[model samples]
Target: MKHLFLTALLAVAMPAWADAVDTLKRFVQEVRSGQAAFTQTVTSPDGAKKRVTQGRFEFARPGRFRFEYDKPFEQLIVADGQKVWLYDPDLHQVTVRAMDQALGATPAALLAGGSLEKDFRLAPAEASDGLQWVEAVPRDKDSQFRTVRVGFRDQALAALEILDNFGQKSVLQFSQVQSNVAVPAERFRFTPPAGADVLEQ
Candidate 1:
């Protein structure tokens, strides 16, 4: 019978890859602090082309984070655990750096900060759309998004799919996700809107 339907399709795809690697190890270990509302897409690498944006985010793990980009414009990006601001109120501009020199292992430092198996090398990624995927890869060697695909649905963290190294692709899609709540320490503090135009390093 065709090897029992290929062993029952690997027993239902190996328990959905062990529940999407236990929902991304319980989403970076119990979701310390989070807030979300996002929808981003920027593809271009033979996939025709795309560009959509809408955001509102906040986070506070070991480092910190905040991004508030409304609709197809307006932007801001903070980090404040050492610095990494990037505001652009219609190009009035403000850009700083030094969050370990601008996010070391990238993917926004593995989605806001630290210790994912000490810099990532995870796996288990299959299901799509409905979510449940997880694949990180960047043991740091000057990484600039070479692979990172995190997604989960019921367990939270809606989606994310960076993959760059010339093959552009960035597809984030989170919505109303609020975990651990209570985030406000100035939302990662980025104060700089007086005539703008500041650039540090």
Candidate 2:
């Protein structure tokens, strides 16, 4: 009789505990076994501001990642736990920065840290404008973006919408996501060509 009562109480309390913030935290941990291969689409601002590139991503824990753009151009961004390298073969340019400083207020930090509860306040995922939205506001103003709205279907991450200070919105939709794959060691490391200009930004 006591077991039955406890089970019923827990069932009633479970949904309340599975809040937006908690869900994000759980998802991060679920994907943290080491690596993932996901595609990203970055849409530039309005009026044909720039090219929309589709890219493949490889990510490993403890600050390592690779972004390889495919369409429009071939470019790569790699972070090897200590330094970040952005290389564009067409432009023959390489940009390097310290990893910690480069990740300032970026979504990668949230994904890599699994610390959503520390950085964000959660509200209900709303349905407005004929779309589903989960609103998340950063706890710190220093965060690069003002808000991150994760769109969902059946509680899976369907899309991520980021709003910057200028009110510009960048939305990323992830497809064909394979989590916990064994990423190659070379993907996270970068070597610039001898003649390419290396700018420290």
TM-score of 1: 0.33
Instruction: Find the candidate with the highest lDDT and give its number.
Output: 1
Backbone clash total, candidate 2: 0
Global lDDT of each model? Answer: 0.78, 0.63
The best candidate by TM-score is: 2
In candidate 1 the C-alpha lDDT for residue 52 amounts to 94
Q: Which stretches of candidate 2 lie over 4 Å from their true place?
A: 1-20, 33-51, 127-133, 152-156
Which 10 consecutive residues of model 1 have the lowest summed lDDT?
A: 1-10
lDDT of 1 at 106: 71
Q: Report lDDT (Cα) of residue 179, candidate 1.
A: 90
TM-score to native of every candidate shown: 0.33, 0.74
Q: How much is 174 displaced in model 2, in angstroms?
A: 1.1
